[model samples]
Target: MTLGSRLTALPAVMMTPVAALMLATLVVLAPGLALACEDLTNRTQTAYKAGDLATLKDTFAAAEANADCSAETLQWMGKAIVSTVLRSVHEDVSQGGSLQAHETALREARPYGQDWRLEAWLGDIAFERGDFTEAATAFQDALNTLNDEELTPTAPDTAVIEEVYNKAEMARLAAADYVSAPTTRSGEPGGLAAPSYRGFQPAARLVPVEFQFGSTLVTPKGLRALRDLRDALRASGTQSITLVGHTDPVGGMAANDRLSLARAESVAASLRNEGYTGQIYVVGRGERDPLQWVAPLTQHQYHQALRRVEVRQ
Candidate 1:
């Protein structure tokens, strides 16, 4: 029988909307398992970005419940996880968390296949992490995958081909033979790499935290932000934090310096209480390095911006 004949012979009960599109070439048509898996591809990326592990767990279960552990699901699942991990690594490096976050993602998704976008990201991650050879190889693999008619559903456009070629050539400049890099520590448990660092612009304020004026107290809102920052830093294997405090040009300039140091110490104490054993370095730049240079029209705006400790991981 011809390809059309086989599709036509499929029972009505087994027909999905996807299966009906005979002329289309997407390999996403099947029963309950395949459908859930299809939905999972996007949902997993969303949940990872939101820092909602609970939601990720739910999505994983929904996709797996009806899944037959097929090759397609495995490939897409690996792709989703790779995306999550790449986001984490970049976010870490950008946020001063740690650049090492890319290792497990690279090791985990490599077995899936020569997925173009995934390999492209893998190349960038390796390049940024100083693994030039892997970067070259992965980018080359991406270019090859994009060129392969059998592997890709459609040939990549000229623009895409040019972009991939540019990235690959850049990698080749620094490329050389090197040993395969190790994955994350063998004893470390595998879990979602976090904070969905895609389009992640760290808040303009100091570590997205705020402090009460004159007192060493952190506001409730500040506490929540600090906890999130602390967790991500620790999870990234960061071993130390530096807290730099600043104060508005209020009261005696000298006195403000003392107060600022006190505030930094207060925040440091809170992190210690939370079981962060790493060294906490505190510095006070009272009215010295004002974030708001122009005298604010109002006192509230001036003090609010200055009265905080910035976190450096």
Candidate 2:
């Protein structure tokens, strides 16, 4: 069955409202390295054509373990593995195939190749299991990949793309709301924060803070999302919070640096308004730091993920 068909076919209990539509829009949407892996090409190609998900999974895992597979070969195997997963998402997740297991498989396959389709599936499964934070990130990852292609004049599925974008954005907001949900209500601290610049010291964490495009104005919705972060500070007795600003590689370096810093300042201001009395530290990395960097910058979605303020807590 197609991805959309598979989604709709899922039991009501397993599918989210956004899950159905989010995957439906993806209807229109690899090689490896190894010499001892000479047989790798034939085996992966055969499994892909035959829709053998089990074999694809085994082959990918083995290939990865062998340490001899070329990037091209592993990437091909990764695509095949993803295809099998999509073809069998429902069965895999419903029949003793835990969401975590499938998610783990996809995560392993991701470095081999990253694309809109894989990320969309990742988002779909995450949403299925109520991991909205992960769902939001995966969906945004897919949207950014899609948007990167949209920069081309001949981009197809423009309408379908927008539908997907709306749903993805909605998922993200839902995630933010979940994060903002009181600890008393959520029964836990916020889900793992959005990814931050890797090279940042003391590790990078993010609040659900968002800013308007090309402007430092924090959205009203974004302002509301800071409650969880504020509460976390209170709970931890953390005396200070650090805010690091980052931007997508859309504009000049100097301009992005300034914009990123400005964006962080905006969030800092919002935090104070939200009753965060701690010493707030702010700095901007500009385009120097991105959560995920895709080339050509035409891929606005990837850039979108990069453009944000992160909290070092």
TM-score top scorer: 2
Candidate 2: 10-residue stretch with minimal lDDT: 193-202
- Please write out the lDDT profile of model 2 over residues 122-156, one tens digit for every residue: 77666655566777677656655444433112232
Question: What TM-score fits each model?
Answer: 0.37, 0.42
Model 1 CA deviation exceeding 4 Å by range: 1-205, 292-299
TM-score of model 2 (CA atoms): 0.42
* Candidate with maximal lDDT: 2
lDDT of each: 0.54, 0.58
TM-score of 1: 0.37
> What is candidate 1's CA lDDT for residue 190?
15
How high is the lDDT of residue 274 in model 2?
Answer: 75
Q: State model 1's lDDT.
A: 0.54
Clash count, one per candidate: 0, 14
